[model samples]
Target: MNYLELDTPALLIDREIMEKNCKDMQDYADREDVALRPHTKTHKMSKLALFQENMGAKGITVAKVGEGEVMASKGLKDIFIANEIVGEIKLRRVRELAKDIDISFGLDSILQAKMVEVAFEGAEKKARVLIEIEVGEERSGVVTEERFTELLDFLKQCSNIELLGVFSHDGHSYGAKDQEECRIINLEAQRRTLQFAELARKKGFLISRISIGSTPSMIFNFPILKGITEIRPGTYIFMDASQANAYGNFTRNAATILSTVISIPTEQRVIIDVGAKGLTTQRRTKGFTATKGLGRIKDWSGVALENVFDEHGILNHQKFHDAVQVGDKIEIIPNHICPVVNLHETAYLISDGKVIEKIPVDCRGKLK
Candidate 1:
């Protein structure tokens, strides 16, 4: 089937570009001597996760227990929930998952550890975990050295849990003003994570995995840092407009929404079939890159997705008067691909205008 025949507002993945993105990251990890555990949240599909494994990813990382459960159900053995899974119901589910596969999650607080301990107490296998260390992201994880030591001590008392190592995300690197600042952020983030790992090892804990990654940081600073066991990068698999803006290259963006111009409402404005529903409202942040408006128009350079309704996307550009007309098709490189992917049921794999395969968004709506 031809890509144009697939209807409007369709999510398309370019086969060539997607394969290169996965292989390039894997090769970089191989050269750096670090494990590449590509985060599954971006694509949210078991086939893509399995494709990463086939390309030499050490494991796969998911943001929630539900995502992990979906991956595990597809026979993915090694999985990491890179977010804190708290509450009795969540922890009980985590324990049940651990019974079948090598399951672990991020830990930043003692309250979370206590809950995990209770969830797995007297079980045959303990819940494996990686203590999250704050590394300038300030989103989650233990920040101070005092909090780090205290959390380790608390985990020692938890008979139903086993500490795997440490993990950190230099998410702030994404907001870096330039490559120089991104390099600095990545270095500091890794340094702080390693310091916490060393402290845990000194405290008689077996520190095995020292993981750190954010696509912006990893792309700029791989093979520079040593002693890091794994790097978990999610967005690299499907480069988005924001990533291309920060990292400089839209050519690597494999995922895009194939939208068609439905109406030329005015000389300066055109409406596309996709809206905020298909192309998420996320935009490129200041200091990251200089992409104006909401999303980048793939075929039209100066054009942008100026605004969106639930069902209609507004494209306004002075050039729209001659560059596009009613019923003309255009592809939109989303400001963010992760959320945009979740909004779709299936993604059509395309190659040179031909539809190669249809892949389900298997983990779509797994928000538990």
Candidate 2:
């Protein structure tokens, strides 16, 4: 069946475009001689993760242990949880997963390392972990050399932990004013990450992987610093409005929300079936990936979602309202595809306007 015939408020993935996106990123990684470990948090689909792996991705990257479990159940063996994992229960779950697969997670503090050591105590496999280096995203990870030294010194006493390597996320590159700024930020972040890896190696730890990524940085194809082993970009798999804006076009956008015109309340007002609940309320306010409104209409240039309620999207454009009539199906490219995908249960894979497959968001709400 045609995607247009599908129910309103549906998530649609252009199969051809998505496949191209996967190939493009993988090819870039191969050319750079770096491993591609695309983050699965963007699509949350095990099938897509497997597809990426089969297309030359060395491994898969996930944000949570639950997502790791879901992907492992679908046959992904090498998994890395890129976020810091604390708490006994969660660490125990990670421990259980490490037994069957090559599993690892992030660590930034000796306290979390203690939890990991205890959780994996007496287990056959030691807990493999990576240290997160803060590279100006300012969210997590060690920010200063002194604290990093402290954490490393403490890790020397841990008996059940194996230091995998160091990783960093140049997320702030999304807010870079231009390509030059993004390049600077990407290179600096990679340099800082590699510096930490060298520090760890100097301290007698075998830092095998020096991973770093952010979609904007990778999309710009900035020079990868030597010794950086892997790139873990998530949003490249399903380009959103923000990423499209960064690229100056929507041609690369593979995911869009398919909604139907529900009402034309006035000549200046048009309402669609999807709202914040379906399309999300995210907007990129700065940098190259910055978007103007909540979302962009696919075929309608200069028209955007003005406002959104729980179940309604308002378009305050006379031309758009006049062009589209009630019951007309429209596609919207969301500002941020990551959260928008988590709000959906399944996404329809479309090829040449035909619904080719239904991919489940298996890791949806796998926040634990």
Best by TM-score: 2
Among all windows of 10 consecutive residues in model 1, the one with the lowest summed lDDT is 218-227
lDDT of 1 by residue, 1-368 (tens): 98988788899999999999998898889888889999999999999999999999988999989999999999899999999899999998988898889989999999988888888888889989999998987799998999888998888788888999999998888778998888888888888888999999999999999999888887664454767899999998889888888877788999999988888877677888998888878876666754677789886776778999998998768876577777877888988789999999999999998998999999999999
Give every collision pair in model 1. Answer: none
Query: Which 10 consecutive positions of candidate 2 have the poorest summed lDDT?
Result: 315-324
Could you say which candidate leads in lDDT? 2
lDDT for each candidate structure = 0.88, 0.93
- Alpha-carbon RMSD, each predicted model: 1.1, 0.8
lDDT (tens digit, per residue) of candidate 2 on 1-368: 98899998999999999999999999999889999999999999999999999999999999999999999999999999999999999998988898889998999998888888888889998899999999999999999988998988988898899989999999999999888998999999999999989888888998899999999999977889889999999999998998888888898899999999999987689999999899889999998888888999998898899999999999998888778899999999999999999999999999998999999999999999
TM-scores, all models, native as reference: 0.98, 0.99
